[model samples]
Each structure stands twice: as C-alpha cells, then as structure tokens.
Target: MRGVVYFIIVMLVASSLGCISEKIEKPDKKRIHGPKTKKIEEKRQVDSTRKRLGVVSGKWEQLNGMDGGDMHFIYSTRSGVLFVSHGFGGVWRSKNGGESWEIIKQEDFTDVYFYDMEEIGEVLYAGSNKGLWYSLDEGESWTKLKTGFPEIDDGTYHLVSLAKYKDELFFTAVLDKKYRNGRPGDGRLFVLKRDKTILELEAPANKEITVSAKYPYLFISSPYSGLFFSTDGKRWRKILDKKTTNVFVDGKYNLYVGTIGDWWYIGRKIGNTWKWEQVKIPGRKNTNSIFYFLVPDPINENRLWFGCGGVSRFYSFSARGFGNSFFGVGCWNGELKDWKIHSNYATSIAFYGDEKVKTSCGEATKYALVTVGRQAVQKTMDGGLNWSNSYEGVFGDTINAINPIKSGILSGTIVVTAVSGTEIAFNNGEEWMKGIDLRLGKEVGGGKLPGYPWCAVSPERRIEGKYDLLISTGYPSPFRGDGVFGIDTSCLVRGGRNCVKKLIGGPHYEMVISEGKLYAGNMDNGIDVLDLETMEVSKIDFGSGVPLIRKFDGKLFFETYEGKYLGDGWRWSGKKGKIYFYDGRVTKTIYEEYAINFSVNNREFIALTPESLVYKPDFLSEEEIRVKLPNKKYTDMAIAWEKGIIFLSTDGEGVFYTTIDELKSGGVRLKEFNNGLLTLKIRNLVYEDGYLFAGTRGYSVWRVKPSQV
Candidate 1:
C-alpha cells in the first residue's frame, strides 16, 4: 500500500513536469526592434563621448517655442550683421547676411527685452530692457551706461530708442510702473550729450514715447499725447499732436510721423517753413496704419521709406500710385522707376510663421538619456532614442553609479570613496540642482579620491518624499577599508539638517534592502548585512564571487559569482552546472547548467540567464524554461519579483523591460520605448511602485513608467 501511494505521487509529479515543459517553448527568431533610428552609429558615438565629460552638450533643441514670447531682430551697422534675441536673453548672431546664426550668449534674466541700437562715430549704443549699453570699439565690448539714470528704477528702466544727432545722443526711457503694479514715478526722456552728460527734457506725465534725432531738432512721439519737437535740451514744441506712436527724420530735416490711429504725415522744409502734408498711399485707406519707418539711403533725400503695420513702402515724393510698396534695404539712383521688393523679404514673409514654432513638450516634460564615459552616470527618458550629454555638477565629473530616489529624482555617488556632490531634480529633465557638496568628511583613498562617491536611495527618496539616501566609499584594492554612511528619509524632510551616521565602508559596489535587512556589497570585505532594528552587522563570505542579497516571496536570497543559496541549506552549484537541495545532513545535485540568477515568485523558483528565464516547480526535475530576451548587448538586470517585471539595460543601447510570464513563455514579448540611446551601458536597475529606474556608470540616472512605453 505504501509503494502504491509512492507510485501515484511520482506519476503526478511527472505529469506536472510534462505540462510545464509543454508550456515553455523556445521563442521564434525575430529581428529586435528599438526606438526609431536615423543616424544610429553617429548618435551612439556622440552620446558616449559626451557622457564621459560630465557636461551636457548641444542646444536644448526642444525649447524652441511653446511659450508666450516673440523674437526681435538686432542689426549692427558697423559689422553689417543681423541677429535675433528671443526677448528672453538668448541671443543668436547672424554674420552672413541672415544665412546662418550662432548663439552668442544666453543669460538668465526675467522680463528683459532688447529695444534699439545706434552707432555714433566709434561708439555703439544698445538700448534694451535694462537701459543703455555703450561699446567703444564698434560692438566688440560693451559697458553699462547707467550713470545719470534714476537709481530708484535703473535696472527696471526700459530704453525704447537711441538716436545720435551729430556729437550728441538722445534716448527715450519708459518707466513701466504699471507693469510693476503702480510702484512709483512716471516715464521720462533723457538726452545724453557726447560728453556723457544728461540733457533733461520736459516731457508729458506718463506717456510711452519714441524718439528720433535729426541734427538741429529732435522728434518725439507719444502714443496718446501727439508729437513734440525739442531743441537745446530744454525747450519743446508741439508739431502734430494726434496720438502718434512712431517718427522718423530724413537728412533734409523732413519729418515723418506715424500715428497709432489712421494717419501718416510728411512735414517738409519749404523755405525754412516746415509744412505738414498728408500723403496718400495705395494700400486700403482707413484700415491699416503706419507703425514706423526708416530711411537707410544716405544719398537720396526725397526717397522716403514707410513701414506701416506689416508692410514697407518707398515713395519718391512725386509718384502718385497706391501706397508704393518695396521691401528690403538698398539705394535707388532717382530713376523714377517702380521699386521691387527684395527676394530675402519674400522668403522672410513666406516663413514668418516658422519663427513662432516651438516644441510641443515644454522645457519641463521632455526626457533625455545621458551617459558618462567612466566613473559617472547617464540617463535617457525617451528610451535610448535621443540622448543628452553627461550631467556633471554633482560629482565634479566623477560619478561612479546612480540610484533613483524616486520619479524624476536620482542620486549619484563618486568612485573615490567619499561623499563629494549630489544632484536633485523635480521638473522632469528641465533643470537640476547640481554641486550639492554634502561635505561628508575626508577622502577614502590617501591618493586623493576623484570625488569618491557611491550613492543609494530608498524607495521614497524622490521629490515627493524627503531624506532616504545611503552612500559609502573607500580606497580601491590593497588599501581598502570599510566606510558606510546612511541618511534617514525623515531627517531629509528638513533639508539635510540631520546628521549622517557611518555604517561599514569598503570598495562598495551595490547596496540593497531585503526583508527589512540592509545589505552592502563590497569588493574587499565581502557582504555586510545590517539589522535595521538591532544595528548589528553580519558578514557573509561569497568565496571567489561577490555577495549579493535580493528578496523574493518575503524571504532573502543570497547570490555570488558562482551560484545562488536559497536560505535553508539549498545551494545551486554552477561548477557542475546542477541544482542541489540538502537537509543539513545530505546534499543532492541535479543537472541544470547556465542559470545566472534566481528569485521566488508565488512560492515558485524562477531562474534567469542572459537570454531566458526558467521556472522550477518544487524540484529541478519538474522545471520549465522560456527564452524571452534578445541577444542584444546588455550590461545588467534587476528583477522586481513581486511585480513580475525584469529591467534589462544595455551597453550603449539604453534600458528595456519584459514580464516574467512573457519570459517563461519562451516568446520574446518585449516593448522598447524611445529612451534616446544607442548604448545605455547601464549598471543597475531599481523598481518602486510601477516605475523603473536605471543607473549607468557615467550617466546620471533615468526613470520611466511601464504604461508610458
């Protein structure tokens, strides 16, 4: 009867093994697919090289637009140059007649705008949101000219126009106190003589003014207070006060005033008597109005240029055609011929809308994959599709490994075995707080640690939570020693005010927590597991392999370079390539080779290799293997057993993932997202909630959600 029962159990076990093996089938060979590729090899090289330097390269191409800002043009007469300032301090200068442009400078200043420029003899004057800037050597160098300005509102003053009349210069300064919420004072116009002295002029109370200097007289226009003429720095006379906004003067002293309302007047010098006459142009009458105009021709006096609304016109003071229109800037030899618009102007008009085009994702939400060459970390949020350069500022260009604290937050530790710097970010990949020198004591190596740092983060150590950081460092090899530091999440809530306690230190590689026990892997000192409650440490010898601890099914599992130990006395030996289970007195070995790592999911043992996952039910005899992963180059893997997910990072290819069931089914069912990488060369993977975080050698850190892919 006992033998009969044993035979029934054996039959059931055989049947179960057959069923599991039938379910696990080898996946069909298929071409691996990643992110969209264009210049794959070139991008890979650029991404890798930049990661080594610890400085992000290339312009933030994604921040072209999508904000409420306008682009204004700046021209240099001395250099015949034209540039564009994105009103916000980003300046791009074009040298080749608007053919191409290069960024000159991008300063971070709020509510700043560049207004006008004027070259007087050898000095170049620029009017902007701040005030006036004077360059002595023809725009080569500039100095702030804010001597005689009002100190109460100097930086806030907006200079609208700068006009040079002979040796003297006159400028219109608008004090936008309204924008400042009725702070104090009104707008004024200050005339600066060639001697750098202010020539005070009597102006209206609080009107926005525009000015133009024409030798013996200066023309000023207000949006609502009409036109005024000033001479000798003090006296002013009303010329055509009718809500005018812009004004221009020719070499012959003929004044042209444009009104915000529907009016463009031409004041001619007839026998010393300035007679104002209204000239009619061809454009629709009473619908469009002139904004401003400029006469670039130095020779022709009667040749008038009119800039109305969004169009430009040229009139000879004689031809009677509907508003004579001509674009571009050049001279005519007084042939009384119809003027033609320049081709460049036509092209500009054709692509005018392109100027406002911006990336749909603003500066905050975009993701970038970054990598450092060595001793640093890299990250890419777009799945190795497009990558940014390495982020330095943290480890002073010496980052060893990265651990994700939480979503959009990462921590990097240096290699030299000392706490040097840390970086934190909250707004996706837009900006980061760099150079957070925690100043956590001296170097590990007596030979000067290259910003020696190695960092680990708890599950809640992101922007949403506080504290939760661990770091350790020590000299490499023969001089190795134990030094570990830990930071509690609650203490970080108040901005790192709490002290960091020392744990154990050595050439630490990885730190993990399993079953409420903290474990630190060291190269020279084996593995140290600390009891969070008792504060006691236990050293585990991994023999020739490094000791690693991981949690599965609420139980801790130990791994070494050779094989794995599943708590109790069960040990899987890779020497004979077999599995064994012992009840302390006897040991058994079963034939099963090429298994790399194992985890327990739902009380079942799951094994992993470079390209597959194996599931063993109860004993090795009843086992099933599935080939899910591709043969692509990979560097590391992290499994979240409870979530049934596996994160695989590649060398220069970025990070990817798959499910446990998909892997056991032997059919590679993986979804690769756009992470912007050719080779991520990741070093580690961490999972918290449903987000997967990747750590790379030189790359900072990266994170993404399962559903986001």
Candidate 2:
C-alpha cells in the first residue's frame, strides 16, 4: 500500500491530563527585569550573505506545516520510501507505504521547491525549481547534484521532470520567459549518455515532458503547440490541432491525454495508428475538466490517482474550475469507495462584509475571498455557494494573509492583504491597488529573505493620537526575530508613497504596544522595551532572549524556553522553557512545561505544548484540561466567542475546532472544520462573521463556516 490514506487515531490523553499536578512561584528563577531606564545599543551586524545577486522570489510558502501546495512529484523507492513534494518547499518521505510519513526536509533556500523525483538504480534523484538533488541513503538525506547543470541567467533554474528511458536517462527543463542563445530557456529536453555529458532530444522545448512507465514513448505537452510525441528519442511526431494540456502514460502503457474539456486516452501497443477515445474519470463520469497527472496507485494495484486541475493560466476560470477549485486533486480506488476528493490545498482565505449584498429574502451577505494557488483570487459573494475569480485586478498570486479591514470610515471594510514576499497591497472592496514594499528601502538580500509578510494596525496607545501601521515581514525564522516596520497609517491613507518606514531590525518573539510602551521581546541578544513618549529603548533582562510575550487575563506573560516533550525540530531547552508573568519590575513563573505557543480567550489561559492545547481558567486550579487535536503540530488559532469555538490552524490538515462548551464537557469531539480546503496544511487562520478564513501552502486560501461544516 503506497498512497495517501486517512487515518485518525483518537487519543484519550485528555482523559488523565485533567488531574495533572502544578508547581508555582520559583521567584528567583522567574523574571529578568530591565535595568530601569538604561538603553541598549545594536550589536548584531546585518548579514545578507547568500542571495545578494539573485532576485529573491517565493510563492505562497509555509514555514510551519509539511503537507500542502500542489502535489508536484511522487516517487516510490524499492526500499519502501515514498517521496512526495508539494507547494511551498514541502518534501516528505513515507516508509510504510503512504500511511506513515516523516519530514525529510523543508525549505532552506530561496523559492525552495521540488517538481520530480525518481529512483535511478540505488540513488534517488529529484528535480527542483532551484536545481537537482540526489539522495544516496534511501532518502535519509539529500544533497544538491549540479555536476554539469547550467545556471540560468536569473540564478534560479526549473527542472520540471526527470525519467529513465530504458538505459538512458532524460530530464525536462522549464523556461521562465527568459531567453538564452536566442532560444527560450524553458524549451529544452536532454538525455544523459555514458560518454557524452548531455544530448538534446528532438522533442520540442518549453513544453512539459513525461515518459511512459514501461513503454518506450515520450510525450510533451507543449506550452506553444499541442502534444508532441517521440518514440525513439531521436525522432519526434506531433499531435497537431489537438489542444492538450498534459499527458501521462500508465504502467499498462496506456497513453492518457488531458484537454481543456474532459480527457482522452489510448491503450497499450494498439499499433502506432490507433483511435483515442474520450473516457469518463472512472467514477466521476461528468467531470468536464482537464487533469494534470495520472499515476497508478501502489496500494490498490489497478487503481489510479489524478493530480487534478493544477495552477496554470491554461486553467480558465471563466470556463469554471474543477468545482470552486483550480488545484483540486482526486483519486478513484474501488467500486465501493468510488471517486472522491478528500482535501483542497487552500493557501490563504479572508472575508469582507458587504452590507449591500443580501439574500432574496433580505439578509446581509459577506463576501468570502480565497487565493487558490495560481487560480488567483476567488470570491464567494453568497457565502461558499459559488466561488469565482471573475473580479479583475486582484493580485492573489501566492498571497500569505488576506485581511478585511476598514481603512477609513468611508473606505469601509475592504481588503488589505500581504503576499508571500515583502509587498503589501490593499483592495477597497472593488479592485486591488498597487502593492507597497514594506521594506521601504532596506536591504533584504541577506538574512532578510522573502518570508510571510504580515500587517497590523496599532490597537491602543496611539502615537501622537494617530495609529501606525505595524508590518512584519512574515516569519523569516519561525517564532524568532522577524523584520518589523512601523509606518504612519495616515501616510498610506494620504498616498505618501515615500514615507519614512521605521525599521526595527532584529529578532523578537513579538513586538506590541501596551500602556504607551513598545515591548519588543526576544531581541535574540536581549529583550527591549521602548517608551512611546521618549522613544528611549531599554534592554529588559529577560532570562531567555526568545521571549514569547503574550497578554492573558489582564496580566502580561512570556515564555523562557521549551519544556519536556517536542512535536518536531523545536529544541526542548530543558526546564528553562516555562510560563512567566511580568509585574512591572519582576516576573513570576506560573505554569512550567514546553509552552512555545499560547493564547488567552474569555479569561482562560491556553498553552500549546508538543502534546496538547492545555487550558486553565485560573492559576489557582491545579486541574488543566490538556486536549489535543489529531494533528502532531498546528499553526495559529482564533477564538470565536459567538460560535464558542476554539479554532486551531494546523501545520497540515486545515483547521481543527471545538466549542468551549464542549471542552468543559470533558469528553469533546474535536471536529475538523474544513469543507472547501484542498490542502490540509494551513499556515494562518482567522474567524469573522461565522466564517473561518484559512491560509494554506499550495491550495492558496479558502473559507468555510464552522457551523456549515
């Protein structure tokens, strides 16, 4: 069995955790107060090392989860390790078929992505947008293999596909509108020979290349022309006039051609001259759309999985998507199981209230906005009933966060969103405006690579009676130091294009304003607190520079380090990681454990440990209902008071939500509130007007009402 399967293991860890013990007040070990009004100087140097000359660009990528984006490539090794690549820079390997998987590696460089992987003899090879990678130790580790590969002029290269043809190996290169030697870079296919370094095939360039599993046929789905076939590698044949989007050859050597409407195929060795028949997708007979990849499932010997509707401009939204999805994928197993799509890889989702929009019976309607990968921006005016990208000028390409905000009293609640890079744009409930660089003019080539850029408005302590736009260049290093920029909100409203952006360059857990003080915790070196009136910066001697300062129950709290158990690669820095409450001068250690991520809702303290989302109403109660979702790790969360639900954004697997009333009931059913989300891996989530907006890795963004789910 070597395919993606759903396995939910219900854990009753919540059963016994309610009786867990609690320790309090290690006074001397707690708070690290500031040296009164003493200021600290900058010491860390700005190091922009690797990608100085390269144009840094990244699509919607998630630094948190593993399972997302488009499933680009999947290769099963003889050793039983199945390597799969998706959107973002997600690459994972499963040893026990596709039932159990582990994160081999994630993104490390600029625009980290893998497209194809193959098991060549003993060594496994992978083709990525950046370059080629090979694993010698059964995918335990991977190393870049760039022996003779040419570096493109843009510094980045896209190796689309790779396959073995009998004894000779062939690879396909994807060009990105850049020209070289009077030829488009995307238009090249080459074969590796024993003596010769490389040999270009007779096949057309710039088109997608694919090979048959056992047959000696090579097919190219051309971006310029239609389909081109090369039987002997040296000679080629064109299937002209037949507009094909993609091609695939099954293990039975069945040639399947994908067109804009429906699919056509021809069976094995039926002679060079055969009839291509339009076939129904096993169970989905009426699905009038094209598919990308066709692969025989290893688990169900005769079954197949279709990488449906990918992110391509060829995927015409005007003609309708694969039912509200551009990057929608599906699989057909057996007669009983039938045809099904378990997930939708949504990147980021948001909502904008339209008081003007109402139902026929007359009820106010709120527009739901979602970025479905290359499908661009999709909106559902009447909730999730009908989603369409009909509206023009929305720059939804790889957006990270989509926020609906009231820019001004007259502007109303429109869209002010951030893409994967450093740019942030606003849409005044009509069309998208030109995005502004949050970097302003600072150098982002070095440690400052393109990350998930986020924007926020100062909630309180208005500087000079005016609010400032606080923007952070996504999570460059998880919960560590991220780029924070403060600009006067008035400047943006007044169209002050070249306004001065105050760049507080350093690492911090989080920066915020409370009681007229700007607290920048986890400075990497030390914690810094700035006075709003004086603009004086004083170093707070927090025990750990990695301080996650959060406000809960009218008091300020922070984390020192990680505790007991770990979910993933996060360092469990022993007993150092504990919850501490700050009382002006000193701190008090409250709950001790690995409290990396925590939140407060309705007077309850919620701590996210490796094991569970521990909740405590008060510090006095020794009882803590440590409930956890089915996921190993999760992303951000939102507490919907009206819905009385605690929504958790997962690393993968969309949102896991449960009602606060149910948590008190002890035996709770933590339901998955994902309806239209194709990708399980979620990066960010927000709940508004009974709608939950989710930001995914590859599927882009999607929204579904919790009550509807």
Segments of candidate 2 deviating more than 4 angstroms: 1-467, 473-483, 490-497, 523-526, 561-576, 628-631, 688-690, 699-701
Please report the candidate that would top lDDT against the real structure. Answer: 2
Over 141-163, each residue of candidate 2 has an lDDT whose tens digit, in order, gives: 87775537566213345666677
lDDT score for residue 220 of model 1: 76
TM-score of 1: 0.37
Q: Which ten residues in a row have the lowest lDDT in candidate 2?
A: 1-10
CA lDDT of 258 in candidate 2?
55
Q: How many residue pairs collide in each prediction?
A: 61, 32
Per-model root-mean-square deviation over C-alphas: 27.8, 20.9
TM-score per candidate, chains pooled:
0.37, 0.44
